[model samples]
Target: MKQQDNRALGAWSRSSTAVLAAVAIALFGAAAWHLGTVALSVAPPNTLSRHYPRWIADHIHPELEQNWKLFAPDPPQGNGQIEARVRTVNGTGARHTAGWTDLSASDIAAVRSNLLPSRTDQDLLLYAWDYYALWHDQLPGHPREARLMAANLKRTALQRLMPQYQGQRITGLQFRFRFDRVPPPSWASPTTTDRPVNQVLPWWRVQNKDCQGL
Candidate 1:
């Protein structure tokens, strides 16, 4: 009788542990699913708003449109903007303000001319471009390539920025992209809080102002 009771107790302990482990796994899975849903809701997959022009378009209901303001906006207005500032070593090895600009093709060329003229500097600039491209969704070749480029750009940008840090640290060379909702024209304001303009425009309409020409 004593032996049977001991055996039963041991079996019950094992069963309890198994049940607890199963419950823990279920809880973890639920949490993971919830987090994934939230992320998807905030930033939908494959929206043009989430990627650059010229990349593969997501075939969903709303296609993405390209805005030149991303690179070279005339008077500059758009969701994607790159602002670059540079500091460089002066002849006396003291740091001086090199320059700053919104990153257009011209701006990129200027930065290359001023700071990264050497092979090393060129490499760093390439890295920075790749890094920016990844965020812009311009990288479509290979995931590995994008990853490598982002890493290299971060490393090179930091290396280039470090030598020029004077008593005042180089504080503000940053890149950011965001979603901006266009406000309704005065005529349409009374009807809605949401802007009437399409969040994603067609590819043809992106750069071209005349819809008829498109």
Candidate 2:
């Protein structure tokens, strides 16, 4: 009986080792496939990359898509920030516009001096604004993308700035972008100067549904 029990234990150990080996192989293969697809997707337009554009895109889009521009060669030369304000209607039906809230500044503040910054603070509004800009060129253009971004901005404002607008119903939202080009070093261009450009967009009407859940 002791010999039989030892034999059973040996068999179980072998089976467990085989199972673990198979799982490791599967995980390694999955990682390899993901990395390969991501490489192909971000690589410069080559014959192979061009051939499997759809496949590569399918594997590494909207989530794993890489932006090489974040590094050297063509990094952002200008800093851009988005600010927002809300047009509110009081309980008595009086309309008023609130002070401009620096949304980008708030995000920067949250990320600064924090070891583990929240992803929402880091990427949420940043990516939303980037995608919105990609889909939109000018004010009153592309209602679909504009409405979506407006809703997101309004939701953010409601959460962050709600205390300031107590008793007032937010009815509209406005956005503006401030951009400042980095001035060249004095040694490089002693006379060069930089200026900040402020682009104020028209107000977007917000409905109750836009801020339904805050």
Q: What are the RMSDs of all candidates, in order?
A: 18.3, 6.1
Strongest candidate by TM-score: 2
lDDT of 1 by residue, 20-76 (tens): 999999999978755544444346464543454222222210223243465774531
Candidate 1: residue pairs that collide: none
Worst 10 residues of 2 by lDDT: 135-144
Can you write out model 2's per-residue Cα lDDT over 72-188, one digit (the tens) per residue?
556556788888898999888899988899888887888996999987667677667666665465534446556566556557656666677888888888888887888886678
Count clashing residue pairs in model 1: 0
Alpha-carbon runs more than 4 Å astray in model 1: 1-12, 15-96, 99-128, 137-156, 174-214
- Deviating ranges (above 4 Å) for candidate 2: 51-55, 58-76, 79-81, 89-99, 102-128, 134-159, 167-172, 183-214
